[model samples]
Target: MRISKEEIMDAAKKLEPRLIAFRRDLHENPELSLEETETAAKVAAFLRSIGLSPKLEVGGHGVIADVVGSTPGPTIALRADMDALPIMEETGLPFASNRPGIMHACGHDAHTAIVLGAASILVERKERLAGTVRLLFQGAEEINAGAKAMIRDGALDGVDEIYGLHNLPTLAVGMAATRKGPLMGSVDRIELTLEGRGAHGAIPDQGADPIVAAAAVISGLQTIVSREVSPFSPVVVTIGSIHAGQANNVIPHRAEMTGTVRAFDPAVRRQLPDRLRRIAVRIAEAHRCEAELRYIEQVPVLVSEDGCLAHAQRTIDWLLGAERHAEAAPTLAGEDFSVYLESVPGCFFWLGSGPSDRAEDAYGLHHPKFDIQEEALAVGSAALASIALLRGQSNHSLLL
Candidate 1:
């Protein structure tokens, strides 16, 4: 039996106070990636308080638990990232981060709270559920390692499907968005070291000048996106960091550059590293320097399966009305949730948290002032609960 929309909404509404409290507590005491021991403890305690036994430290501080149904069926896993970023809180929202350099700038606090709220709602309707709801409070999402760690520890061992959400500051409160496939991009890192002879800045012939080679390599990297790949296939090659000489006059012996590459197509993603390596190495050599490149594949593109995406769409429409659902545009931002989707059929969606509904007016994720609308908490909780409750069921089961 599927739980009614009203029941889930009402339960989420009733739990708002506790949800806000839990979210605020998490916001005030944020922990960085792979260091969420206290956060996991609190989540586990909350699960235990609701009479569910959660497995602690599943993947270096990840917390996992299940809300079993009266009848045996497929297990639907709901995930929440628990780690914060390294930015200092500047929101001044009364419950700003207590940790000096750690902040919940990515809304993982909201995600964690929303999943906990869903757990509460699911527990109350446990007898009516046709399947189990697994709760995954993952750590280190900022580093993109949490999902892999949890999966390695068997987080998806018995789970047939999974679902999760990230709060979007641009999406307005009371609204939700997702797409059928390729919702987010894959993230890869590139590190290039250019080696050249060093000499006095005044004498150009005396030194190879790796700094000049670095400049040429940087400019050459952009051509791969514009000249090599198809304009229709989106790809981003960003050289975010560079280091070279200590003194202004003396030429540096070595120059190092680090960057990020994002793409949507798997074929495009696979070709980026080779293109980058060739461009950087050949360019540096042309400038009389030797180049060494390291390309690290961080996360794969996030594609939402049609089945799970349809369930999420129906759930959102039923709970918040058809007007609240949106066909979200694909983003180049990387999410570790994509890792879970790779292991099982699942959907990762956006929960509107924008105060004015205009995302541009608000700070984006990873910003020092990044935050979400508190009202989105209950909406997200209800959406997550409704999705799991209606899993493997027909569209006619929706109250709408």
Candidate 2:
């Protein structure tokens, strides 16, 4: 027996008010990455109330629960990140974060509520499901470590395929979007340090200024994208922070800089470390200084498997009219859900939560004033539940 689309949509609509309250509760008590104790407790309590036993503290505060069907089939996993950003709340909503300097600026509160909503709907139809549904309430997504932590804790031990969604504040509420391949970029960090002789600012040639070398290296790094990389390939190398001398009269012996690099193509991602290092070292050496560069690759590009993407599209169309589905444009933003895709074929997509149809008119994610339309809560829930049910009822072999 397969759960019908009408059932999922009807359930989501009826539970919209509770979903909003749950999301507001999470928003009021936001926790930072790896510090989600109370949030985890709430998740566990909710799961228990719904007649499911959730494994607490999996992956450093992650919550996991499995909904088993009467018949045997493939297992599908749904993920929702459960962490907040460091920004202070500015939305002034009655349910705003109580923790100072911590806010759910990334719609993670809504994501958690939406997944929990799906869990409730799935539990009601568990007897009709053809396979099992694993719910992953992940932590530390802001630090890009939650997915790995969940995996280490065996979140994906028996999972056949996975699906997850992130609420896009810019996208209009009630609309959903996704792409076939390379939907989002990979995340990599760059740290550079330059060392040179220090002397008085008045000296003619007494000091080898690391500040000068650092400037040259930063300029040289830009050419890696303009001159080396192809125009068609999307890559971003942003030097977000730099530190050097303190006084006007003294030349600093050491200068440090930090940056982030992003790319959608794996080959381009692989080439970044060497290229960035080469530019920094050669440029620093040219200015009579030595440079040390450290490039750390964090997450891979989020590539959606064709089969899984098609499944999501069908779900979105079935639940909300086919016109509601959109082919999302690729972005340089990185998501740790890519980590799950590396191990098992899956699709991570965008669910619209914007206030209006003009996505550009709304505040983007991570802003202090960032927020999602409450209506998106039910839309996200129905989409997630429908995705699982549709896949579960199908022939797993043919689908995946």
Candidate 3:
């Protein structure tokens, strides 16, 4: 049941220019999370061109196109996110984003293009395959809604296993990286509201000011990770934004602050919000003010299946060899695709997309200037298609 890797590579190479154009087009006309109207339409058109009946608007711009093989076997799903970031492109390329305040800085455009290229090849080789293949184009990944929406819409109807990939700017091209577990961290949002009486700047004891209490609460949160959480595990609590007084002379009665908590294990992930609430309330009580704390779970940690990534990584090694590949370093950043891992055994890896010339200074994903090297498209497509077809000796259970 060996697939023609050479044929797959040839097809991918032939489709490289179109894939680049699609990526650039998606980059030029980037759409925000959950609002991928144009992007979805373009994907649908491309699928249709490749003779796939793409179901549109599934899970708010998420799309699925299935390819059924000649013989019944298993359902393996390949997913790609299509949503863009709110960043404005600054790459200065000819196909730079025409839309302001929106860009595919995350390399989702490359993900979509590679998935589309794989779709073209998979359709051609559909009859030779033994099972079903699903191409999942998800939207709203940046906002953490698309994956859930797709699941609610039954994106995993016949899926037995799923796989997805992302681009890594720091890694050099021709390399891919993955791991066995906890590849990404869980993400949750928390907010603190401090309430106090407005006070004049010159008054020493006129009223209780929440601004002072909030400042204490913010600083107090720092001790949670250093003193409370275990040093062995990585935990991050960051206050990204704060809003308080508008005037210089008077202290505002209400001060609001929002921050994020990230951890790999569920125990710590749950502990963070509770600890934040306790910390803020105690700090505010000391200042004669009251604090309200709220925690919202955003995305779960991305845990790669044990031995599952090894097979995919082997496929990558066959293509790129060992020299270019590097082991992926864990990050506190979160991905909603963790939701998919909840239901099935799978792994999400990163394809190195930066140019070798400026690998040290390559622009990172989610940055306005983030742009991938064009050659990475063919590399990604060939790797994805090959891995999807390469069922290793360890896949005995999956085969049966």
Winning candidate number (lDDT): 1
lDDT of 3 at 153: 96
- List model 2 lDDT by residue over 111-165, tens digit each: 9999999999889988767689999999999999999999999999989999999
Listed in order, each prediction's TM-score against the native is: 0.97, 0.96, 0.96
lDDT of 1 by residue, 221-338 (tens): 9998889999989999999999999998999899998999999999999998889999888988898899999999999999988988888887788889899888899999999999
Model 1 lDDT vs. the true structure? 0.91
Q: Which sections of candidate 1 miss by over 4 Å?
A: 356-360, 395-400
The most accurate candidate by TM-score is: 1
TM-score of 1: 0.97
Tally clashes: model 1. 1
- Model 1 misses residue 245 by how many Å? 2.0
The full ranking of all candidates by TM-score, starting with the best, is: 1, 2, 3
Which candidate do you rate higher for lDDT, 1 or 2?
A: 1
Better of 2 and 3 by TM-score: 2
lDDT at 218 for candidate 3? 86
lDDT scores for all predictions?
Answer: 0.91, 0.90, 0.85
Cα RMSD for predicted model 2: 2.2
**Candidate 2: clashing pairs of residues:** none
Candidate 2 stretches with Cα past 4 Å from truth are 395-400
